[model samples]
Target: MLDDETPVLDNHLHLDPDNHRGIDAVRDFARLGGTHLLVVNKPSWHLGVEAETGEDFRAVFERTIEIVDEASSELDGRAWPVLGVHPGLITRLVDDRGFSPDEARDLMQAGIDVAAEYVESGEALALKSGRPHYEVDDDVWAASNAVMRRAFERGAELDCAVQLHAEASEDMTEVTDWAEEAGLPSDRVVKHYASGRLEGPIPSVMSEKDRLETAAERGEPFLMETDYIDDPDRPGAVLGPKTVPRRVRWLLENGRDEAVRIAHVETPERVYGIDTEATLERA
Candidate 1:
């Protein structure tokens, strides 16, 4: 039997028809005391599919919503939905097959318009986006803010959260500034994959830790994710299942028990809009 205290939450998972393992994986997770899973529906550049126009993107977004609804209904509280336009795809949108920057911006705006609609519908739990190496163009940043502002407006109406994937400490700062400028609650902006952004040989001593601590101090919730699937070859890429427990142990050892608890404990509840008191009591 799995102990209720065993912490688990797949904060950033890509669930597509091509890669889905079906309900059995979810059942296994639940059987092991996995409290929640936030299924993020964002385009993957690695997969080579791009949603350039609003209508084209809405189709995929709607399909993703359907998937989450199905999974949430089937699992009975094991799964939830997160929606966003990934940053990497933003690059693809701008660097179109053979278009100018102006053309790319026009294309990206179309997708942003559709994302705004999803946020307005209360179907999305949070807004998520990630840059590969923390490098983002001003136009892309502006577009992201426009989308975020629309989401914020709708979030206020529906009482939802905005989850973001910041690739570096600087990226987090830029997003934070935009959210602040938009008057969005600091709490609404949650950071994902925080530990993986460190660049130096000694990541521990780098600014990533400081950035996480600073965010925590500022009342912004930061999420630690394994983003890993079942693959063993890609150990450091995503948070592999086999590596999660060890990572948690390391967090516990490094005086980051609270961070662990925040990532494993508070985030899922917030994202899923669940009452975690009962789960915490069980733990």
Candidate 2:
């Protein structure tokens, strides 16, 4: 029997149309024991380098909304959706349009406004790909922060949480500072991909043990994620159906369990927004 007090939340997951297992596969995963699954919507055009375009960007956002609408009713509160303009796409949009920094910021803000409505309806707002472009020095960084600020202001009113993808320790710190400045509760903000940096050409890695240890020392409660199985064909990407239990075991072995929270299993309740009663029945 499962312990009543054991906590499990799949802090990161991708449920786009391209998922090999399809939505039903994710649903089955959640039925096992996933408490919460944070789902992200990515633009189809941005899925690969070839399909990227301004029209495709908008199409992706629209499709993401459609997907959420379909899944949310079935999943209920079990699935939390985070909507945002990915940094990589933002860079591409800027480069493609030849827009000045100010123009780019305005465009991104517009995207956030549209995304906020979805969040206001109970979906969480997630700012994915924070490091590659939204750093202090980059022009897009300020724009990205502005987008976050808008979402934060709206989310605060609704008691919603905003999820952020942190690529580097510095990026994590920057995001934390921004959240603090906005007077947003730290607990309301969840950072994704907390595992230590992995050695490779890919941008994201498991966060270093020391980094997580330090966060724990400071009494910060952040979410830890293992975004395993990046498509080698598509560089700079991460897909789902994570090795949850195995990753959790690794953390326990390293004595990092107390430093982070792990969701060992993902069920439909967590991944697809299924109803609790239904989730329990499935479990």
Candidate 3:
């Protein structure tokens, strides 16, 4: 069983109130001992925002903030907003909106700039950006990388973490270089949906039983996440919201307290610079 002293944080998650379980899913997490969530913005298209201008992304970012606020109140947990453009949206801009590769990249950078404004104003904690996860031509790939670099620059400026959504691989040295080039520390960049194969950037590993066990055994620092999509049609697609806390509970029950503390307590404090346990105590 999870003790109240321990804090369980989901490093990356999404909640769409109009179309999914939303706060109800958060309640499930809190019930299972989750105490903090880094709620990220979904792609603009998911929110029905056709971004002809970069400012159009405000709708998605604002909605994400609203959802986080609601989750904070509805559950016995804390929720922080992480706003940014999803790299896959580049394809949507090209195919659906007929944007050229360069134009799409520029618009995505502008979107990251707008998200940075939220972080500047303290409405959000971090910015998210990354290249396309799927295969693409050289030109598209280059443009995607440029957009990700822009996100890194903004994160560096704001002194906040940047959650990345990029290709899955062990060697993230290339992405780490981009972040360092932009003056953001490599450790401040979080690799979402990670499989523990990472260099430089911090890994927000999916909370699978074996994966968690391996991560604990290695004793390297990492954050845990469910990456819950919160889509009704694809219910529990990536992972369910209750996963992190339940997994943490199991780990705790199995004498993995030190790893749990590193993941839930130390890593988040170092990466995001927020003391969730302190927040919980104040509550």
Candidate 4:
């Protein structure tokens, strides 16, 4: 949407393999002028795994890294990857597969430990984790919290950025507190699928135009995202990948170029420590 073809980056979206989008979602996003994207992988590894071992968990993680490699190669370095044990996955592992809370926690921690290695190795730029579901039993709620706590702990140990998926507009003080206790800072977190008005030091991957305008006035740092599920059942659920650039263009037309630049470029480069210049050079 830029008049000058300035590359746009999507900070969050699901580009899992075999998505209903026949071609790779990265390509789809890129086709819309999105030069770079962060694949927040939540399902491909767990669309339900039958194997039940710590080793198996590690293998699944290894496969996720492979998927990232394949996508990067296919897209010529525009696809950045993120890995984590989402709360929904934890729910299924315990509720459907009959895992004890402790068992589920152990498996998730194992996978997260492996993902942290990828983070350390620069294979993954960020970690994705949070209570993705709103309503649930007390046990599921507690387990989700425990698993997310472990995610924060790993992010802290590795000093990597973490993307949080939670109920939109919810107060994020709890999450910030969790990060603080995990030895991570609130500024290291990115609030995914956010409503944009939520108050916090944590940056949000936001979409609302009003909030974008407000953020522009307040000089808040944020990133834009579609959170496109990529599931045909929920076709274009939250939005399309083009949403980021479209919003950026609108912001620019409305005289908010500074805000657009901060959200689309500066924040992502700073938070994930990505070499955007190197990424463009790869092109």
Tens digits of lDDT, candidate 1, 175-210: 555555566655566655555333211111112345
Question: Whole-model Cα lDDT per candidate?
Answer: 0.52, 0.48, 0.89, 0.70
Model 2 Cα lDDT, one tens digit per residue, 1-283: 2223334445566655554433653554344433444567654344542233233344555565555555444432355566765555456556775766567566655665556666666544443334342444566666656666665565455555565554444335555556556665544555555543322111122434454454445433344444532233453355344334334445556765564342223222232223334333222
lDDT of 4: 0.70
On the 0 to 100 scale, the lDDT of residue 135 in model 2 is: 44
The better candidate by lDDT, 2 or 3, is 3
Could you say which candidate leads in lDDT? 3
Which segments of model 3 are wrong by more than 4 Å?
none
* TM-score per model over all chains: 0.68, 0.65, 0.97, 0.87
**C-alpha lDDT (0 to 100) for residue 104 of candidate 2:** 59
lDDT of 4 by residue, 100-143 (tens): 87787777767677677778898788888777556777777787
lDDT of 3 by residue, 39-154 (tens): 99988898899898899999899989999999988555589999999999989888788899999999999999999999999999999999888998888899999999999999
Q: lDDT, candidate 2, residue 204?
A: 22
* Candidate 3 collision pairs: none
Off by over 4 Å in 1: 5-7, 19-28, 44-49, 73-76, 130-158, 196-221, 229-237, 241-261, 267-273, 277-283
Task: Tell me the number of clashing residue pairs for each predicted model.
Answer: 2, 17, 0, 0
| Candidate 4: residue pairs that collide | none
**Which pairs, if any, clash in model 1?**
226-239, 228-239
